[model samples]
Target: MTSDQYAAATRSPTDTDVERPADRSTEPAAIAVEGLTKRFGSGDDPVTAVDDVSLRIDPGSVVGLLGPNGAGKTTTIKSILGMVLPDAGTVRIQGVDVAEAPRQAYARVDAMLEGARNDYWRLTVRENLRYFATIGGVAPDSVADRHDRLLDQFGLAEKADVPVRNLSRGMKQKVSLASVLASDADVVFLDEPTLGLDVESSLTLRRELRRIVEERGLTAVISSHDMDVVEAVCDRVVIMNDGRIVADDTVANLRQGFETSAFRLTSPDLDADTLATVRDRFDVTDATTREGTTTLEVATDSDGFYELTALLRERNVTLASVATVEPDLEDVFVELTGENETGHDGGDSR
Candidate 1:
């Protein structure tokens, strides 16, 4: 099916509650930032929250914003949404300059920044949805229809009449997402959308976000600490550290670029001859022999695995198994930023 058709099929009921252009272009960028910068405090104590960051989010892509705590991801989002004024640089939403036309720029983008939630102690879940729908300019006749759909899609149908204050944290987060989906903006900014959610809920939300981006052609900018979340949901990721964009690449490319040939071996016994053979053949990072068993962790590239294996075989050493260790985003983050070392810690901007 076509992308638009897919989006329409999986669209939430409240999707029609907000105003959106019917002719979203495949090539048009939903948001763009050039030389974006934000500073805090006075001259001597001034801290740069965002440092000359430049990025362009495609019209219908899900881009993951990842970093350790205090990496300026939040500051970048705030600048894009006009929540925090930039000391310098420019932010444009759907071709509208945010600095020059804040309201018009933000009108095309709907966001759920950190600490932004849709909860009214006095209002029921349905009431809250309806209220947000109205505020988002959904027509009266469509509000209830959209509300029913969101309630069911988010698995909150049973709690429709229940007040928000009584719901659990996960349920509240679901409500907040439903509210944003109800807005139906072309571009959505999700700041820690899955934070504090259970595994099942997190999975559900990730699936929904993917569906939204792929089917509806919605552009999304997601800020998250969970590497697994970025791996599963984002097509590409931008890593930040010390208020700078350290890396930007597809997850697969990053994985392949950082692939390491590492192996773990276990054996019941190790003779002196076999130990000598192993040492001559492999650059062993660690070797431990205990309880009449030996285990070794060795690092090699693809071309060297065979030679290492051949040497072990020549010594009549018993081999359990050899496998390449897969590199994760966390490993790449550390390798690129060097943040794992001391004296280089940074905080996510408030």
Candidate 2:
């Protein structure tokens, strides 16, 4: 990621800073952010990277953070982790304000962040997990068990002794994530967990993550550009645009609830005026005539189907076929984030 969109995991809590869990068992939200705002620089040139964003995560729920580059998603997560101080607003982890009580808030959390920046490349896979877990406050006696569990869960059992530098990018990515789980934190934050790797690797890791989160009853907040990953792993999503939250809901609701039925009308022959005539009564995303057929894709509800088809008949376009296209996660993401590309989505991918 270029510019300030680069995601960074800046905090490394000591064993004393963690170990004992925060006294937040009764808290409803594992992570709570309210009216968060951050601006870099000063005066007229100030860039507001996070603006008035607020969200809450129920315990044991997995939520996705999505947005275009420079949308302040990275800044928002850093704010929650207390790695980046905000210009305004409050971030509370399990009822403890991060800015006011970083130790208490951080005690319950572990993060596998972007670019594998959280790992020590010179260390072996198992060594990195051991070090991170101990430093993050896992007990010395439990380190070996944690290490072995992480290696097996990540399918790195065979490469447990391999140095981080020697493994492929995908293997290293798995190691990075395994370290987060090894910490045994109550809350986990994964920034672009599927940024690297091929489709198969991504699928495997996502499945493992789901199993881990569910089995452990862990609360997780994941940031990613991979819509498929979000759809597969997240219970809900909070979408951002230009530093502000635009949508927050479940994937199914985001895909089905926010969308109107879009229909594609095909005809053997058609005229531009015919499309214009249909446009008078319906919303059209695109209409193109290729070869011997004209195809028009338009947004409408079920009730509008009869009206649209009848209009086509009135226009004499000889509608050959008509079918509805339901919006997918990708379509919803683009519509909400308002940008198709983002640098924050990936860097040094496997």
lDDT of 1 by residue, 227-289 (tens): 777889997889887788877767765555554767777776568777777678778877888
Model 2 weakest 10-residue run by lDDT: 1-10
What lDDT is reached at residue 252 by model 2?
63
**How accurate locally, in lDDT, is each candidate?**
0.74, 0.78
Model 2, 6-103: lDDT tens digits are 11111223323433324443667888888999998888898889888888888888999888777888888878887788889988887888877789
Query: Relative to the unseen true structure, what is the C-alpha lDDT of residue 237 in candidate 2, on a scale of 0 to 100?
Result: 81
Q: Give all TM-scores, in the order shown.
A: 0.77, 0.76
- Candidate 1 regions exceeding 4 Å error are 1-26, 143-146, 264-317, 340-347
Clashing pairs in 1: 7-215, 69-348, 70-347, 70-348
